[model samples]
Target: MRFLLAIICCKLLRLALRLLGRGGTALPGQVALRICPDMLSRLSRGVRVAVVTGTNGKTTTCRMLEKMLRDAGEDCFANRSGSNLERGITADFVSNADIFGRPRRRLAVIECDEAAFRRVCGELAPAVCVVTNVFRDQLDRYGEVTHTLGAIREGLDRAAHATVCLNADCSLTASLAADAPDRVRFFGVDAPLGGAAAVSDAPRCIFCGAQYEYDYHTFAHLGGFRCPKCGYSRTEPDVAVVSVGALTSEGSAAEVRIDGELFDVAVGLPGGYNLYNAAAALSAATALGVERRSAVRSLAHMESGFGRMERFEIGGTRITMVLVKNPAGCDRAIDYLRSLSGECTAVFCLNDNAADGTDVSWIWDAGFERLFDAGGAELRLIVSGERADDMRLRLKYAGADEGDIRVLRSQDELLEAVTSAGGEVCILPTYTAMLPLRAALAARCGRKEFWK
Candidate 1:
């Protein structure tokens, strides 16, 4: 009854949203109450669910999984708009249901929030659950990265029988391999260039409480290593990123050897970090029997969502918008930026909203060091949004020259600053700040390749 009511409410909300000239998310809470007053039990049908959860790359990873599934001729229902919570997931399932309240797809791919995994997973038992990584994020909301990792751990514990995809490169994720060895499949990137790059590493082990050694360090502490004391290390990736050859500011062209044949591909998204994401998705899809070549080709045509490594041409200059919500991601973005040369301007915006952590202190850990390491005087930083001052201070703390940093109180002004700054601007902002920045750039630049 609860599931049925929710389905009815979702239809009513869809109608109300259309009539009110708003998105489906604009519906009031009472509408859901009116429709779904009972428990949502429809999760137990023949419907298969696959959940992707992590700190930084959940959206991208989930997006890839969704596409691969669809390409494999599976009718899939996915949370493309990033409604990872109960409400968002419910809205998606409810709105996409048939007349009898059955889903229109053979499977579902949902991006579950790091902090809300247990709660959301409780509603839907996924046949496959992928944990991207547990990185330091939103300390105010989650306290520590462990809190988010704990949520995934809790879900994995309960759904012990589910096929678990863990990141062998991520220390925290690799640790889970020991706990649920029978159900977990570890996928990692063999960072052939790991020793040469300046990257961050995850510190201690969750089990034995000792520092894990790095055989190689991927970006921001994710890499090959093991704990000597407790023997916690990357336990042989089922799918390892064997080669991440050349990727420039323009895009990346590389090959991942799957089943002896190196599937040659070029991805529009910048960063080998993305290749890592693609590799993980490939592993999950292969586990589900998606054709390797079709999945490989499908990746080249992916559309950028929000500010997640999306590039566009503006005023005859090509600019890429990379969202940096935490230290690991910010570091990866900058590292990828260094992979190119040419004048690049950037807008760094922050928001301490509920979605963004109220504690803006996490910015300190974001390796603002990279912006400076790339050469301080060369890169000018435009700080914007509610936490503009915070961004400014963080840059200064990283020993950035005051002349190189400018703080703009308004998001609109940030765009104006970038336009007039004279270079290809790389807009780096948090989740809330990304849309407004995108809107402002789209208005003048008139780029629609990523608008939808």
Candidate 2:
């Protein structure tokens, strides 16, 4: 009775919140979990669930998985816009079920935080789990990348029967396979990405503490990585991006080999990191019993989720918003900026909110210097947010000319600058900062409100 009451109340609250133009991802779940502590597990029973947890790409990967499942004609739902915590996930489960607490959908794709995975998995015991990749993120929250890995390891240990999809190129993520080798599936790029590698988040082996050797580098630390001392190496991927045929600011095309089958894959999203997400999603789909061809076909139609490289047009300017929370993710966003073919306006938003690591020191670790150098003198830079001045200072040190740097402290000013920029505008904002900008843009541009 408590479970049913929790579900019904949370559903009504979610509806109420949506009607008020508010995002209903977390609070409803929080209230529901308080009403029934075991609500998540009760609601999750008998569902084929795929839980994706990692430092990055969880949302996009889950987006792909959900789409593939929907295309495969399965009744499915996901934690689309909510918090990715125990409570938020529970709330999502509640919302998908009937008032009697019976599931309307038999499949789910859940995006979970690394810190919350262990606690949540014990209840859900998902049929498939995908660890996108581990990076040094929110040091205040997760302590270290290894600690994040340990958390996921614990989750996998609890769900021993779940098919685990690991990233072969990421040493930190690939190491998890050792815990569940028989049930693990690997995904990664087959050949070198041919760029100077960014500073590796995992420079030493997780097991031996010895420096790693790479056959080639794709972007950050991801590549053909191998440990010499203990002989831990990247296993050949079951879902491999054999070659990226073309990568542009628009999208990317690649030849993806899934298991023993090869298919030409084209992702509608930009950036090389997105390629990894596509590969990871395909691997997870196959693990969840979706056909490989269907998964590959779905990849061609996948759109960017909320703030992970989402694009919009407003007031005559084209704006692409990419969310950056850590040094590695920031550097990748900067790399995407550096890849633009012509001059464009760049907006950098930094916030020290709790969701975005309180310690903003991670920005110093990104390749901002390289980004500024590549942008040349013509690039216009705008810094906005709670820490706009700090971002501006960081840019000045990154080789941005003083004359080209502008600071917009207000949302109206920032939006005006973006709309009046007269060309392609790229906005890179930290977690909290992205929220208001996304809301404002959506309101003016006729896009669906985040809650809806």
Q: Per-candidate TM vs. native? A: 0.90, 0.97
Point out where model 2 deviates above 4 Å: 194-196, 374-377
lDDT of each: 0.72, 0.87
Going through the candidates in order, what is the number of backbone clashes in each? Answer: 6, 0
Task: Estimate, for each residue in 1-452, the C-alpha lDDT of model 1 and write its tens digit.
Answer: 66566666677767676676555442432356355633233633667888888887888988888888888788887877656766666666665677467767768887888766886666677788888888778777776666777778887876655788888888877777666888777777776543223334357777887877777776776777778898766777776667777776555677676655667777666677887788778777876777888888878877666578776566665667898877778878777665556566766888878777688887776666665564433565778888888788888888778777888886557666776666667778787787667766766666652313
Top lDDT model:
2
User: How many angstroms is residue 4 displaced in model 1 relative to the true structure, after the best TM-score fit?
Assistant: 3.3
Cα displacement (Å) at residue 34, model 2: 1.3
Instruction: Return the TM-score for candidate 2, rounded to 2 decimals.
Output: 0.97
Tens-place lDDT digits, model 2, residues 22-66 = 876688898898899988888888888899999889999999989
Candidate 2 RMSD computed on C-alpha atoms after optimal superposition onto the true structure: 1.4
